[model samples]
Target: MITRPRIAAAFAAATLIALTGCGANTGSSTNAAADDFPKKGKSIELIVAFGSGGAVDTASRLVAPILEEELGTNVEVVNKPGAGGQIGYTALASAKPDGYTIGATGSPSVVVSPLDPARGATYTRDSFQPLGRHVVDPAVIAVQPDSPYQTLKELIEAAKANPKSMTASTTGLQTGEHFALAQIQEATGAEFAPVHFAEGDAAAAAAFLGKHVNVLVGDVSGVTDLIKQGKARVLGVMSSERAPSLPDIPTFKESGYEVEASTARGFSAPAGLPDAVAEKLEAAIKTAIEDPTVVKKMEELGLQTSYLSGADYEQYWAGQEAAYKKVMPLVQKKD
Candidate 1:
């Protein structure tokens, strides 16, 4: 028999008891107990770590309506931007476990925050109860339309030719995009100065468009408009596969670089929530993810669907955190 991770086993046990309604002894008696698992008449608040119009915000907005319909309750999406998503995640961790407040969190928050010293965040994968994973946003390397470098090779050559002159724009130091760029630099032995922007993706895009930066690294959602309008051209995507929205772009691995990173969006309620409440929230998220409207919205935003319920989501996060830990030390700290 294949051995599973300790957390996976734990999650499987919990899920079997909660979701499948399977007990050691099953009969009409178990059905009565299983009927109590579905929670009714509850309101859930979903906190989006980034500002409005971001990938996370857009995803939450698209899924919240469908979730509202599925749960037969009110679901609200609130924007809480700060510390590259730690502020909101910290807040979510501290909320009451009544299952009323959930947060839509992705990379940097789930994987990178724990590795950063400045954030001062203490919670781990055990802090919150995972509802489910929703989408995966792949990182992309893009440059201003008028830039001399048209391809990843050309950009690498330019950076290799002049180490610090060619600067790349990213949200902040040690962020997901920053890490992706660092991976590129390490893989190719090319050096480019990093430009930090305050407003995340929008600021990074603006810097590139204004000729303040030669390159910008971020998720496809943030730069989709720029790519569509010829303001920016994606050099490569940092994913195992090419994004459907940008079919012409090649993956970093495919382009002879071994860098692959993807940010995942998921829902989580505060820890210690009742199993019934968690089940209800999970079911709602499942419904939202399967909804046709959500599907279309995700496709338009260049997001990949990935659903993981409760224990599975938590275990997946643990693996992500471990990977980030290995990659964090390789990132060059910015002053």
Candidate 2:
């Protein structure tokens, strides 16, 4: 479970479900919303919470053309790109619930934002309708091509030996990578200096590749280009199992550190969308994301397609909301 929405505080999550029980079931309501959607020429807006060129933005751009072909309309990718994904998510939360203003963002914005009040996110789990999950990109520990650390164990031991001397770059403060790094610190008793900047797909990887940062704590997809260019090497992927994109890369667990964290990127619209419209949007998303060509492109970008549509996507996300809270205490909020 990598990304999700409409599931918030424990008690509030329960009450939110009670209030919006229309989304609890399957099929019957979907048919109603599917009828008369788009009318053939509607222009739909797709917002990407992170900056252009990042994984989130890349996913949206890749799907936009195919989505247009499927829906018979224009699908524009709008990048808000700030506040560690809060800005675009808020835009989606505040957008009209007419099925034309859906947005995509990573999981931490959905799962961990509520725990950090400093991020000032306006949308909670109840604020939007989930369209579908697009990608399950696990984080990886990547070091410079010529770095001393050749294995996950070596990196952990080195960090433990030199405390703050080793630095790990992330996309932003308190972001998913930051939390993942914290989990690594807690699990291995190895302290690392967390260095973050926006647009991790570029900046974080650049920092690590240029030797400005010692390590990159970013998604596998985010560092694909770097790895492909031989600018970096992955020490381990942060997933329960090895990622298909990089089958040879060991998981943190395999390296004797029980850590698994990933960003699940997906689409969502403002709450209260008609069942027919939601269903229609979800169908278009699934078709676009799972297309063979699209799947090939994702693989090239080092991403794996993991589509969960409508109610099924919502159900899975609701569970992750609870899972994220357990790691919240370890994260240090940034103002």
Candidate 3:
């Protein structure tokens, strides 16, 4: 019995009310996602760009439990290793910027990957939001126990004489070790044919131990156990000074080479992450990295704990990117 004009007006009112309610609900849900982020029962994924048993993977695993404790949520350490950390880094960059997914980052690998056109990296340094930095492990050059190269000088001399006859193992292309080799070659004319192990230091170490590569160009933490067990003979440590853990080993400078390189590892989330979520993540990471227990564990593994807050970490990476750009042409393959 309703009039046609009255029915139309009622329908319009109903439609307006429904639309308003939907808009309000959407805003509330979004605010809730930011305010109550990392809600209970929700888990965070911590991605490691390297394979298991590598330095990056080890540090991420060690931090995951403490991060979980601080965030009141589950933290899962996921390894997505491949293509010299490109696969994992790509995954991290492409993930939603919800702060629920973060990954371990290292340089000069991460800093230089996107710089190289040949790498075809999808993400640049701006693609990630630096949460915090953890450690800086100095590079080391080692040979098997029975190798004839007794000192770094001997190794350099032999490499210069043989050019590409000597094969060296690197974690991957554009990694710290590769850069170190390029520096050495450019400075001293020593040529070493590098064998890139895209997996990480774990695989590179295995290749050196199995005699597949004549020399191992790796980091101190990656080869500390090998040196202790007398399975590898370290010729030089690529640091400004001798490593405290390896007091007996000398720096490359002391051995008459000016090469020095180290890899710094840290955590980062995809860019555009909510400020609230990012702040919480950065604070939690700072706590975990500064934890005494975590420090002791990292020391035992020969990884030096060097914590840098989110802002400082970003600046540091920017500086590294600038410095490495000058040397990129030196490392490029020559036809």
Candidate 4:
């Protein structure tokens, strides 16, 4: 016995009120869901862009367990080595941005690959979202123990006397080692014969040991064993400060060479990750990098600890890219 118009008005009012209540509930639920997204028991994959036993791979492995402990979840490390880390990096870039798939990328991958178009690389530093930087390992110029060039000055003099006669083995053609070597050469105005090795530090060490190359430009970890065994002698470290592990060795700056370079290893996620998820992942990485276990491992490997959060890391990366752009062209212009 209600009039049709009154009933219709009543229905409209009820519908509007219900819709308003539902909208409020939806917003609250969304905020709650976001707060609970990375719940306990979720798994995170830590991708390494190198083979096992290498510096980046080893560092990632050391950090994974501690990250798992911190996040209260299973953190797994996977190796995807090829194309000077471009292949693994590409894989990381293509992954979902759910904070589940993270990658440990470093110097040459972050700085050099993007600049070297001859390598056919696609992703640049901007392609991935920075999580945090964990470690910095300096490069060193090493020579066989029995080599005639005992000091960095002696080697520079020799290179100046005979351009391209002083063969120097590096990780790859346009790798960090190569960049370091180029920087040193530019600083000193010396020419060194380039011996490119595909297998990285190990092969570079082998080339020096086998008398195939006169010098080897590599990381401290790469030449530590050889130097300890009297198989190689470090000429100069490619850093402003002397390495703590080899306190007796002099830095390039100390040796009168104006050069400073180190390999920075850090974590990153695929591009377009949700801001909330990126925050969670960056927090977890910061925790992982500061963990005692991670610190001990990095110190044992002769790596310096320097952590940078997502935005800060990105800013630092931009500076690095600019530096690479300036330096890479010089390297390419040389013989």
lDDT of each: 0.78, 0.82, 0.92, 0.80
RMSD of each: 10.3, 11.7, 4.7, 4.0
Clashes found in each candidate (C-alpha, N, C closer than 3 A): 0, 8, 0, 0
Candidate 4 TM-score versus the reference? 0.85
Q: How well is each residue in 1-335 modelled by candidate 1, as lDDT tens digits? A: 55578779888889877755645446555444444433466567898766777777888899888887776778889887766677788889889877678998786556677676755777766788888888778888888776777788888888888887878887766677778777877789888888876345666777788888878888977778777788888999988888889999988888788988667778888888766667777888898887887888788777768787878888888888887787787664646
Question: TM-score for model 3?
Answer: 0.91
> Which segments of model 4 are wrong by more than 4 Å?
1-42, 333-335
In model 4, which range of ten residues has the least summed lDDT? 197-206
Q: Write the per-residue lDDT of candidate 4 for residues 202-243, one digit (tens) a residue.
A: 656777888988888888767777877899899999887889
Model 2 residue 182 CA deviation (Å) reads 1.3
lDDT by residue (172-206, candidate 3, tens digit) is 88888899899889878999999999899999999
The C-alpha TM-scores of every prediction are: 0.83, 0.86, 0.91, 0.85
When sorted by TM-score, best at the front, the candidate numbers are 3, 2, 4, 1
**Model 1 weakest 10-residue run by lDDT:** 30-39
lDDT of 2 by residue, 272-309 (tens): 99877877788889999999988999999898898888
Number of the predicted model whose lDDT against the real structure is largest:
3
Clashing pairs in 3: none
Off by over 4 Å in 3: 1-32
Best by TM-score: 3
lDDT of 2 at 295: 93
